[model samples]
Target: MHIQSCGTAIDVNFKDVGSDRDELLQATKKILQKQLVGQSYRLIILQHILPDTVTFLRMARNAGINVAKVFAKPNSIHKPSLETLVDEGFAVSCLDYGEMEGTEVLDKAILQEHALAVQYQEQLVCVDVGGYFCEPLRRLSPKKLPNFKGVVEVTTFGHNRYSAKVKYLAHPVISLAKSPLKNAEALIVGESATLATDLILRENGYLFVGSKVGVLGFGAIGHSTAKALRSKGHLVTVFDTDPIKRVAAKLEGFGVSSSKQDLLGNCDFVFSATATRAVEVADLKHFQNGLVLVSVGSKANEFDIDGLVDAAETAAIDSDGISCLTYAGGTKLKVLRMGKAVNFHVQSCPDEVMDLVFAETVACMATLSTDLPKSVLSELSDESRKEIAAKWLQRGTYERN
Candidate 1:
């Protein structure tokens, strides 16, 4: 199969299970040699890269289609195969934390800024996909905003979660980044840096080596959190109702707990990144004494904040963004960011990481540069995805490895 768009072309050759591995590489090489775009391309492998996959990547690089990046989780790349790819001159920019984008919020310090009303008389307000627009929009309104004429919604994915809350604003709304790719963009850019940065900040300053960490969910955010914690030498245990996710975690060599109680009871630091209500008042009873509860997900209710406030004998925010609380049971806990995303609250995300995500969102917005779409959501052309990738690469946030 072949696909061409955005100044690059992709040619794919599928190999069935038990198919001749040598044959597959040769077939892929022939396709690669036929197409020369004068620029390197990434080989995105969703699953583990077997010997056959490495051979294909190596051959493609020889054909001038250098593997400038490897678009897969770090775990998916077999170490020996990765060694070969690196030895064969592949750049291999793994699209894990390195390609993540959500940390832009911390670099921009959007949280520290007092909510400013939209001052545009008739200008466009583009809420790019960086999860940085919500707090800013809270201060915007027709009455409060100075010279605010209308809003040009550059992205639609934010509507369900953000724009809906600000519907009282009279500005005309124009949703543009509605493409299915936008959702993919969100997945790539939203949680990636947030999880990495949060873990980095906490581990560097607070979480000592070999600390016991419990992750509340096993979804994208939770998975990334667990991976980051594990990388920092923490004994990470994951809690999720989804047996498949639990099994997947176990397969990856991480500890998995079937019950939330098990995770909360055993770990010293518990992070809630489930993107939903994972902990309630009753569950709080299971929390180990002096457990550090940090909410890394953006959404509220992940910790039953109201319940935490009600159950705590004393709750107060510290200068470092930690919420110190004493429960009625006398279990003292330090909740990061008032149970909000810790990175945003502390504004501790590294600047380079934020640049990558901001670059991608800007590139995604540029795809809608032409005539405005009347549709609620639109499709992202292959060109746009390629552009996002290029812009992200151009940002130079993550080095080639």
Candidate 2:
């Protein structure tokens, strides 16, 4: 066992199992028993998709914290694989796709500590730059957002969870920059950097050089996605806003699309990373009827494909319903109906996002020193450095709380 500080969060890295988890849990229980003072907290998040069952609930339980109500979104990028805490008698809410569209009052339940379901809105808003549904909440008219706090997601589809409650938030650069990959290769762009990296470097018996690939939106994820495509010797084209970004993309040997429609009839695979209205619903018609588009940004609104891939068409009510899609390319274009649109958001899990989220949450839960243990920050001393490392790690995989 070891203990150290990596800034505001505590990292208790232990090699022991079974007994170790129990011991740590016991230790955590004792700590929380005193900290609670007496009130519970609402731990609202999409967990359980990671390899290790995310232990927020366990941590909360150990802390003697009552989980007000768990937001078990059915349309989550990754639903609980292990037994959800909700399933085990915890107050879990299986959110409907329609409800998840921002149609319901997520905040009402999230903030109220144990409030039961109430009247929901016609639409809910979802922001997943790394999930299957880019436009997760495109169908409803929600009660106007009162302020930014309730509008934005505290945690994105990715594990980059930073709380708005903190005014002077510490930047986690070093943690994000570390190369988690065993053997690092060229970096890939796209919010779902994991899948993009895997697809580019892995020798799965596929051609790369001269392969036509289109990456829509030249944002952070877009640039990364394009770079990965190029690393494998494939020809890549980039389209996005921000002229400077476009210029930078051009410098990288990518063909920048002046307009969303510019992508038509020029590529085989189109990866949309920009959530702007241009590349979203309106751009669906611009594809050459057989274009394959994958989104790792925002909700899956890159295409106006309601009937094409809605829950009704995919029959997501049954098990594994979330991985469904409606192909827009039709028959000839349909021959290439691939798996879940190369969605890393849905494919990644609680384990993947928790390390970052836990670190952030702990940083908020405790402090950089007094509350945070030294063990967690041992990997990097500075929070900014850690974030940089995390950025590097984005292209690969890592494990931890």
Each model's C-alpha lDDT? 0.49, 0.39
lDDT of model 1 at position 219: 66
Candidate 1: where is the Cα deviation over 4 Å?
1-125, 128-207, 241-244, 298-301, 315-321, 345-352, 366-379, 391-401
| Model 2 lDDT, full chain set | 0.39
lDDT of 2 by residue, 1-401 (tens): 01111011111122322222332223233334543445333334433222233354666655654444444433232333223453456554554445644454553443242222122211111212122121222221223321111112222332232222122222111122222320121122243443533443243433334667787777555666787667767778877767888899888778887866777557766776654333443444555654555655433345444433442223222111122333433412221112222434323322323334343333233232223333321222355335433543543332235
- TM-score per model over all chains: 0.49, 0.55
Per-residue alpha-carbon lDDT of candidate 1 for residues 219-272, written as tens digits (9 for 90 to 100): 655776777778767898888888998998999988988799989888888887
Write down the lDDT that model 1 would get: 0.49
Candidate 1 displacement at residue 71 in angstroms: 34
